[model samples]
Target: MVLSQNEFLPRAESTLARLEGAVLDALSHHGKPSVSSLAGVFRQEARLSPSQLAQALCPGPLSPIGFAALVMRELLAPVDVVLEGSVSEARVVTGNARAPSSLRVTCPLIVLGDLEVEGVLEDCGPDSTVVVLGRCTAWGLQTSGNFLVLGDLVVRDVIQGVYNDESLVVAGDLTTRFLDENDHDVTCYGEVHAEHHLENGRSGDAAVTLASTFLRPELWNVDLGELHHDALFERIQEGEPVFTDAPQAPQVREPDAPTAEELEGLDIEGIAAQASTNARAKDVVYAQRKTGEVWLMRPGSLPLHIFDGKQLLGQGTPPALDVKQRASERVTFWRKRGDLFLEIERFGAVVQLHAGQNNGSLRTFRFAFATPDDAAQEVRRLEARYTGDFLRVTSMIPGRGPLERELANYGGPKTEYTSAIVDGTTLVTRDGERQRFDDEASALSALEDWLAGKRQAGFDLKILEWKPYGLLG
Candidate 1:
């Protein structure tokens, strides 16, 4: 039942409307706001039950961001307590402000302007919230409650949320050195630039950048995905580099082999060492150094995997190949899809195997192999694994491989669903009818009433998944 800020906003407004005029007035105070104080107002004036008050406050499970938005919009906005210029250690602020070096807030704070902090910011006690309307600059932000930034967020060091349900929402760009979700929900509306980002357990994000990545930038060649969270954390804390130089082959030219003098100050040895350790090294036929650069090439390859002294750059079509060995090594495999048998095709080092049909749909799986016999053996393994019509769970190799997941829809259109906020109140019927409320408040009221009835009918509804419908528009 815990909804996002947008969904909960209308519902919160609707809940507040049921309160007595005296209770509403008492809750709307210009002084510092705390959840306990407002709850007392509801208990004393409106006589709302414990469950009722808790529902009004949070609606679902504990969410810091949702709770913060509820308090700000419902309890605090009516009063005028806006401060100007630089302020610190206050519950309400406008203009520039600085948080204490090591501050633990038990009350809700609203920052109307930019807030800068070179220390730790954490929230303790139930319903602690921090709302920054402008830019936020921090050395580290470790929050247990909700933290919402309407503008950009620049964390010089790290940003972490303690629990999975703890909410962190940044409306603009977020720049940080390291981000550990710690199983929390982090939503970034704009771009994210982080040197190291870790999504431990259920924690994740929908960021344009590689937000949920745990790989270290310094150890760019190593894939630490196989390591457990604890091991990864320990390694990172110990400052242990994960990469070692790949064993050199005689055919592979040394970046310093006479060509090192061509590009002075360039780390050719370093680049060559790193390139030899990349995930795509299996497909790399050879590495050739030109003036000012080095090329990692495959058979009939483009200038995709080019190294410019510092790092690998510009991955173009048929990636991980240079133009030298364009027609060197080729592997092929035959694929049968019902009555149609297709000839094998090799694009660079990738070998595509057409697996049998599933649910009357043509399906194919790709694997990289150095020889045709190796490719054929993989095809036989694929055939042996398919019973054609059996459903069961089995273990798979880990990492971001498709085989790791249940083979539900081998290669169909994929759509990812996440928590999203819509503009208006959302309504759906048991018969699949889509409805919307005229206003935000009305939408929330209706949905709450409907859910209450469903609960009474003996259904346990923990989370609600919402999908957009044409009629809703």
Candidate 2:
């Protein structure tokens, strides 16, 4: 009888408009209708019946999303509001103001000024957690489940979106500089950045994985990693060792760069042994973050964990090498469906692979600890398939250079930490061609490749995005 949170959002939006209009008329009449037509449309306009609108939209023991995430923690985690001691206007100042979205904590969530959120934002409620410590502002921040911020929830400025299975954090620094935009599907479990754009507008395919999103075309569906920082590859090319390069400034110097005799016999020491690796990547990618706990991923993955049933969250490694490409290098190994993958040097962030023999057994590919930009920002929240398009990778300011070395460097297509497949092509770099494609549902099918100079005649494709460590390699 405590029914509040705006009276359960108009009775869960009228039971989600009568369960989305009787599940779209029983899937458009293929028909399986009887729950008595979802209980006669919730007893005609929510009078309630037909099994109380099918247990209030499928609620077993009070479940309409666990009773609206327990009435959003009994009405906004005790928020009363009215600051001005340091500043106010719905400002959610916090020392510990009841934030715990799965505890990681460090400090940073300081709003300092300007905020105006109304509904949503419990940080994905469920035990209702949040780990912010300083710097967190709001013009918008909506949530329902699982919110975990550690520091720098800086809008410096504006936002507006955050639905929720939940996770938005900033351990050390993530300055949107002045926001106004950066919604890339609004799902960061951790590590997001902005100097200019992470996603303020062309949000694009989003399902994100930004450790740095200055935005250009750094879209996502899954697996996006960045560390030293490159802002998330953007050049759009797909098909033929995935190409893009040519937006320089990650480090600065141009007047005519390229000359150790044009970078000496290529592979420049395997790009300096993958920029001396150890930025972290020894096969991670795991899910199911609770109970025994798991969230260990680095070379990236995550779109929503689909249903958030959340499981797995294992595997972990990748860190030793650094002494500059282990001394000597030439990486670009290959193996598609059988397993084993490699395509570093230019093609980056495609870790481990493995997995191939499931039903018949034989799938190991381990790596027990090391990939964590907050487990590689949970790979944007799962769900991604690839084939073509992308040449993105940018930088303009003190941002960075050496093409940000694909953040940690791995290379695409060749999944298997959980999903399958292996080997997805990787090679061709002079500047970093963020993307290239032929077809695979045009997000560039995990960076395609078959080569033959990508059948060039006059070929001129473009799709590059750039920043936090947002994405690269």
Candidate 3:
């Protein structure tokens, strides 16, 4: 009757326990037991091959009790052992079977038909033949011969002959004198070194001339006839000239703004003064001659008063000067039929007042000023009044004069891209165009279409996350 792995496990355990006791008794009676003798007895009694038994009792120094424990562990270790020439039909082996304690096939473990071992195979003798019609793994395989793995083969240590079909993965270095015939494709995660040459299967001619070709082809691709050790050393010591296809030019970068000391030598203030004269101070419409104060006039009787640098200094009536005589004298004041006009030519300041209107009424007064030191001070005061901080001005309505230009030097509002979460359902594109969706299905469909379009255009799309929210009634 065929027994399942579950039923066979208990019998295997009981048999190993009995074998351990018998091996221990033999060791005690023989003083220093010979490995070959003990191995021979175990093979006869347990039906294990010499290679399998030898591997179980590894070459090392250990007490008789310790040795027995090691032997028992190796025997009871989880593995699918097909006794000598027992596998006549196809068999599939699975699960992780690792290293010295795992699998042990007695004779040449031949797979005549098809066989699949998913886990591992280790420590097979040189004479043993493992022929798998399907895929298999050899975690620590040690063998050489008519070995054919039809599917993917992951192996380490000596392997010869055709690896047949599918890919062959080498875990460690693949060291061989030559690859006589390798029909299947191979990808080694580690290095591949050959003492001789690597040849193609068809011509059997050398494919690689030197082993260093696997490392650096440019340095090692010299003709063998032209290569001389002494000459090569002399040339290297003399620093051989390297030739290139094109000479690379050094990159030029824009110089950083000059330091304060370097700027001090420049007439930056003079240039600014000239530029300011051409740019009018739109916000500064009125100035007090005595206090050097400025005001923002906005179609009102009492102007929004400001002091040096556009700072809010409060409001007041025009200076009490003799308007009629000053108008006649043309000394900054003019009067016509109860109306008043004043102009401070030094600061380019202008102000006008109409009679019979409330002092704060919007239609009662008109005021303006041109760009000058006093006028610039007034502009700064106005900026301070508008933005709270003297440095920032949101709109260009006030004219980007010297004050605004200074603010520009300090920079402006910073914008950065960040992943935005959608409380409901929404779709957003790379260009910032957004569409709102009432349901998740529609949003997902639109997102899929957008991803497909992006993929066709050679874009790699990554969906960060999708979170669903439910509404409670």
Candidate 4:
């Protein structure tokens, strides 16, 4: 009996082992053993074969036979697979927890009601790992509750539910029907490029500057032209007002004009009368004989000018207008009608006249002279012969128009090479240096005193030649 019992113990132990496994399987409705959960159930209920030593242990079935394999195989087959987990195929990862199959994976499919993360991630740098979205068999990767991925994320077509956890970043390209009816909702924090269609009622937006517009790197393999400035502005934005510099109008008159008194030698003077009630005591106004262009005098103002009815013409300051005269000379003043007026010398002795009607006068005089050292000797002798006993005085009435004031002052102290009106002649210096002045009268006095000293120094004096200024009466 004892020998029989020993032999039967091996067979009974085998049968009981099978029975306990069957019970665990039956509790699961004979579903496949899962690496995820079935192992725990088997460990708790599993026992050693009858009469086997307590130290001896039994290894359970290797892995869960997925529904397909279980249905296909008549008997249960263990399918334990060793695997390495990672974000990408590029690197190795740590974590004992794993999926049953990476390739032919199986898990629950949750169709998305809206686009959102599955609440499983954190913010990270530009190129870090996010989430790996893919198509798996029914019920494959079902976390009991929520999942968060600290890296980036990706979404594939078969992911049916809203992935509400991680923000997405794509090293390559991305596409989706996130807004299409009956399609899943996918919320992403990144930009969308490449060709794609979105689902119904979905909206997408991005923050970008006008300058952010740029060309795509490659259309497959062809190169694109560099974006033009105008097109670049147009591409990324609209409704921003386009702006450029405005065009300016051209001025009517040149800033420079030749003077009649300068050219025609018309230095005659008379007290002018006002023709316009608008004229004041010192208003200066001149009219051209042919064109009737009236040049008005506004002293100390810019744009010294003559005005026609339609346009004002600039007459830049004329050379000093003041010249000395004992008798009548050309004069400027207000007319009775309030208009400013000007006229050449009236009722004067007519010492001489140049052929041209506009040329006020042609005057010449002769003088005796003996040699003197150099520069200005002949001019000094000539001037003494013409007006040795008489003074030629010109006074400029102050607070007058700029046209006459700027152009008319004369006889300033000049530098060594400059010209000075000594006596009545423009004594030009040899080297053409500029001159300075203490006062106009002082400058004139110095030159005059120097000439007198020259004569007293026993330098020979005699008849000298003289001529009137271009402007004369």
RMSD of every prediction = 22.6, 24.1, 27.7, 34.8
Candidate 2, position 276, lDDT? 31
Q: Indicate the TM-score of model 3.
A: 0.18
Candidate 3 vs candidate 4: which has greater TM-score?
Answer: 3
Candidates in order have lDDT scores of 0.43, 0.27, 0.32, 0.24
At residue 244, what lDDT does model 3 achieve?
Answer: 23
The TM-score values for the models, in the order shown, are: 0.30, 0.21, 0.18, 0.13
The 10-residue segment with the lowest total lDDT in model 1: 397-406
Stronger candidate by TM-score (1 vs 3): 1
Candidate 4 lDDT, tens digit per residue, 316-399?
A: 332221122221222222221212222222112321110100112211222222322221344333234324111223222111
Best by TM-score: 1
Candidate 1, pairs of clashing residues? 2-60, 64-146, 65-146, 164-183, 297-322, 299-326, 300-325, 300-326
- Give the C-alpha miss distance for residue 208 in model 4, angstroms: 33
Candidate 1, superposed: residue stretches over 4 Å from native: 1-90, 125-127, 200-473
- In model 2, which range of ten residues has the least summed lDDT? 233-242
Best-fitting candidate, measured by lDDT? 1
- Candidate 4, residue 415: CA error in Å? 99
Residue 132, candidate 3: alpha-carbon lDDT: 40
